[model samples]
Target: MSHAPVLLAEAMTALALQPGALYVDATFGGGGYSRAMLAAGARVLAFDRDPDAIARGAVLSAEFPDRFQLIESRFSEMDRFVNEPLTGAVFDLGVSSFQFDEGARGFSFQADADLDMRMEKSGPSAAEAVNKLSEAALADLIWGYGEDDASRRIARVLVQERAHHAITRTGQLAELVERAVGGRKGARTHPATKTFQALRMLVNDELGELARGLSAAERALSPEGRLVVVSFHSLEDRLVKNFITERADARGRGSRYAPDLPPERAPSFRLEHKRATAPSDQETAGNPRARSASLRWAVRTDAPAWGELEAPALAPKAEAEWKKLI
Candidate 1:
C-alpha cells in the first residue's frame, strides 16, 4: 500500500501557510506535504536523506520548477541550503513506508532480506549491530532505546546464536527475537518491534539529528514563521515536545510560599495550540500508522534564535555502554 502522509490537514492548518511564501518540508518522505503546499500556492524546499525520496521528488520539482525545490541531504543540515528566510517548516518524523514495503530494504521482517535498515543506505546496517556488538551492549541498546523490558533475555539469546552463525537477514533476526521472547501469540505487534526500533534509531542517529534539526529550523525561519512536527513514537515525541516547550518559553513558577523558577530565555516561538493534536478516528482507521502519530506546532517570534538545544539525555546507566559499541 502507498504511504499516506499522517495528519496532513492538521499540519497544513498549523502552518497557516501564506501564498507565494517560502516553507521547508524537513523530511519529504513521499512528497505528500510538499505537493499540498504547492497546491496551496506556497513555495516549498523539501529535504530528505533517502535517495529514493530525492528521486521521486524530482517529478514535483519538474512540475513546479519555479516554485518547488528538493535537496538530497538530511534535514538536520537545513541551514546550509536555506539561503532565503523560511515562512514555515514542517517535519514528518520517522522512517517512510517506502523503506518497509521494499523487501530489499529489510525494514520489515515479513520478507527475508539483509538486516539493513539504514535510511541513507550508507552507514552501518542492522546486521553489524546484531553480529558484532557484545551481548551486554546489545541489551543496553534495546533496553535504553527500545524501552523493552525483555531486553536482557533477547540480547542473551542473540549473543549465543550469533556466535554459532551470523544474524544477517531480517527473517533470521526476527526469528531469534521471537524465540527469545517465546514467540508471539495474538500480539498486535511483532515480538521484535521495539528492538528493531532501537536499532534503527541508533544506526541513523535519529535523535541527535532531530535535536540539530530543531535548531536549524529556528535559525532558518523568518519572524512569525511556523514549525510543525509529527512524531510516531514516544522517544521522538518527547524530544520534540521538550524542544518546543523550551523554545516557546513555557514557563513554570514556584508556589507563592516557596519555590523554584525556570531560567528566563527569549521566547523564540509561540505555541499554536496548548496541546498536541492526534489523528481523527476516521483517519486512524484508514491508516493504522497514523494511530500513534501526534502533530505539534508553534509560530516563530521576532526574538533572536536560541543556540542549539541540548540533545535529550539517554538512560544514564547505559550511556557509556552504548557509546562503546556504536
Candidate 2:
C-alpha cells in the first residue's frame, strides 16, 4: 500500500511554508509531505533512514529537481548536512504503512516472515535479539520499549522456546508470545502487538534517535522557523510535548532558588498552541493510522541560541522495574 502522509494540510500550515524558504521533512516516508511543500514553493531538504524510501523518493526529486533534495540518512544527522539555517522542519514519526505492508520488513505480526524490523535495514535485525539476547535483556527491552506489562513472563517463554529452535520468523515469535501471554478472547489487538513494537524500538534505537533528531532540528531552524512533529504513540508524543513546554517556559527569567525553576536558557521556540492538535474525526475514519496521531508545534524565536539540553530520563522506577525484567 502507498504510504499517505498523515495530517498533510495541517503539517504544511504548521510549518507556515513560504516561497524560497528552506524546509526540512525529517521523515520523508513517501514524499507526501515533501510534495506538498514543493507545491507551496518551498525549498525542501528531506531525509529517510529507509533505503526503500530513498529509492522511491528519487522519482519525486526527478520531478522537482531544483526544489527538492532527498538525503539518504537518518534525520538525527540533519544538522551535520545542512549548511544554512532552515526555515522550518516537520517530523512524522513511527513506522510507515509501506514498512508494515512489506512482509519481509517484519514490522507486522500478521505476516509469517523473517524477524527483520530494522528501519534502515542496516542495523541488527529482530531475529538477532530474539535468538541471541539473554532472558533478562529481552525482558528489559520489551518492557522499556513496548511498555508490555507481562514482559518477564514472555521473556521466560522465549528463552525456553529458542533453546529448541531459533525463533527466526515473525509468526514463530508472535505465536510464542501469544502462548505465553494467553490469547485474549474477543480483543481486536494481537497478544504480540506490544512485543513486536518493543523489539523494533530496541533494534533501531528509535527513542534515542528521536531525542537527537528533535535537538538537531532546534539547532538548525532559523528565527521564526517552525517545528512540527506528528507522533503516533504516547512515548513519542510525551517527548515532543515536554521539549516544547520546557523550552517555552525556560525563556522567562525568575529566581533560580525558588520552587518554580528558572528558564535554563532563552527559549528557542514559542509555543504555537496550548494543547496538541489532533486530526478531525473525518480524517481518522478514512485513515485508521491517523487515529492515534497527535501534532505539536512551536515557532523558533529571536532569543539567543542555546546549546543542547539534557534529555529527560525515562521514569527511574519504570527503568528499575524494567531492569528486573531484563
- Clash pairs for candidate 1: none
Per-residue lDDT over 1-326 for candidate 2, one digit per residue giving the tens place of the 0 to 100 score: 77778988898888888999899999999889999999999999999999999998988889999989999998988988889879999999999899999998999987899999988887567888787777887787778777889999999999999999999999999999999988877667888988898788767767778888988888888899999999998889988887888778733346566576656678878995858889999899998889989999999888765655454444333334333433
Q: Relative to the true structure, how large is the alpha-carbon lDDT of every model? A: 0.88, 0.85
- Candidate that would win on lDDT: 1
C-alpha positional error of residue 88 in candidate 1 after TM-score superposition, expressed in Å: 0.5
Residue 287 error, candidate 2, Å: 1.0
Task: Quote model 2's TM-score.
Answer: 0.91
The list of candidate 1 runs beyond 4 A from truth reads 254-263, 315-326
- Backbone clash numbers for all candidates listed: 0, 1
User: What does candidate 1 score on TM?
Assistant: 0.95
Q: Which is the leading candidate under TM-score?
A: 1
lDDT of 1 at 300: 90
RMSD for each of the candidates:
1.9, 3.7
